[model samples]
Target: MNWALTNYERLLDLVWQHTWISGSAIALGFALALPVGWAAYAMKSSPHGAVRQLSGVTVSLSSVLYTIPSLPLFVIMPTILGLGWLNPINVLIALVIYAFAIMVRGVVDALNAVPPSVLDSAAACGFSRGQRAISVTLPLAGPVMLAALRVVSVSTVSLLSIGALVGVSNLGSLFTNGFNRNFPTEILTGVVLTVALALVFDLLLVAAGRLLMPWNSVVSAGGSA
Candidate 1:
């Protein structure tokens, strides 16, 4: 307990490091998920059932990755990628994969929620399929997409704690070190700070969503009835 108060600098450093690790993972996840989501949305509108089915299968496979133990995934990745322990890149890769299914599913659902008549009207106005997607669909789906991003961000923040198992030091390392040394205060500090970070990020996402998708407020107001 005394050590915990005295190690304030170390605690602060760990928190900052964890935030970067979590942020990087979420950024990577979004970069990878966005195109896949758009592809899935396009496939959903296709006449062929097979294409839609394939999209579903891919999402399902990604979801399965989440069920696997984080430590095992961390251990396996270095061997698979030939990057040994303490590699943040492997942790990032695992987190991105873990995030993929949720993001893609959210995107598809958001796109589907867009009114079909709006899409048809866009086509009637001489917009091509790509144009309709870029303009009509994505614009209408902005709020839902933002919601998905929020979820992914919070999830990645919490999961980064597991990255410490493979020596990717962060807030998780604080908990790991504290626990091994039987330092209860340090362990509690890590837990509290991580939760606080998640809450702060969630609020930031909500604010950003409101700013980016003001129409969502209108939709929400109307739906309250």
Candidate 2:
């Protein structure tokens, strides 16, 4: 207890840094994923085989990106981009790439989950494809999309620890430092704090999702029937 209190500032600093690293990575991932998802959703309705092919190709590429080893990805980026150690930009880029496939898939799945009858109703009511997508499809798909985002958020938080391998001073750095020094107390502290932070963020996201898309609750309640 005494030791932990003394190290409180260090722990707080680690938490803040980790938050920044993970948050930036997830934000960039979402930015890239949203457009890819939108494109995939659009392709589903198009008669063009090329559009479907393109969506498949994009998903596959992103999956490949996710499979690349994280440490190697960090190491290779500095060499290729000439960004030295602990480059946040490179870290963010790699994290984004790592997360892209899940986000895209989430978007695609969410869009697909909308009922055919709802889509037909929209069409009958004179809703254009674009209007239906924005007003109806996306809204209906909100729960699934939020679920996907939750998964991505948790993933990003956990993986951000890997950034410490390349000298990024996040929570992972604290863990690494403690481990390298053979300090059990430090290691335990890092593990506990990181897990706590992850849980807090996860709960916050759940709350936000519920608030943003109350309709999801209705859908979920009906689905059990």
How many backbone overlaps does candidate 2 show?
0
- List model 1 lDDT by residue over 1-225, tens digit each: 577679878888888888877887777777787888878777765789999788777677767767887789888988888887777888878888777767877777888788889888889999997887777788898888878888998888888898887888888887888889998877788888899999988898889878877777764534555
Q: Candidate 1: TM-score?
A: 0.89
Question: lDDT, candidate 2, residue 146?
Answer: 80
Candidate 1 worst ten-residue window by lDDT: 216-225
Output the worst ten-in-a-row residue range by lDDT, candidate 2: 216-225
lDDT of 2 at 42: 80
For model 1, which pairs clash? none
lDDT tens digits by residue: candidate 2, 1-225: 566799899888989988887787777787888888888778766798988888778777777777888889887877777887777777777777777768988888888888999999999999998998789987888888888888888888888788888888878887789889988788787778788878887898889888988755664534555
lDDT score, candidate 1, position 137: 83
TM-score of each: 0.89, 0.92
User: What's the CA error at residue 185 for candidate 2, in Å?
Assistant: 1.1
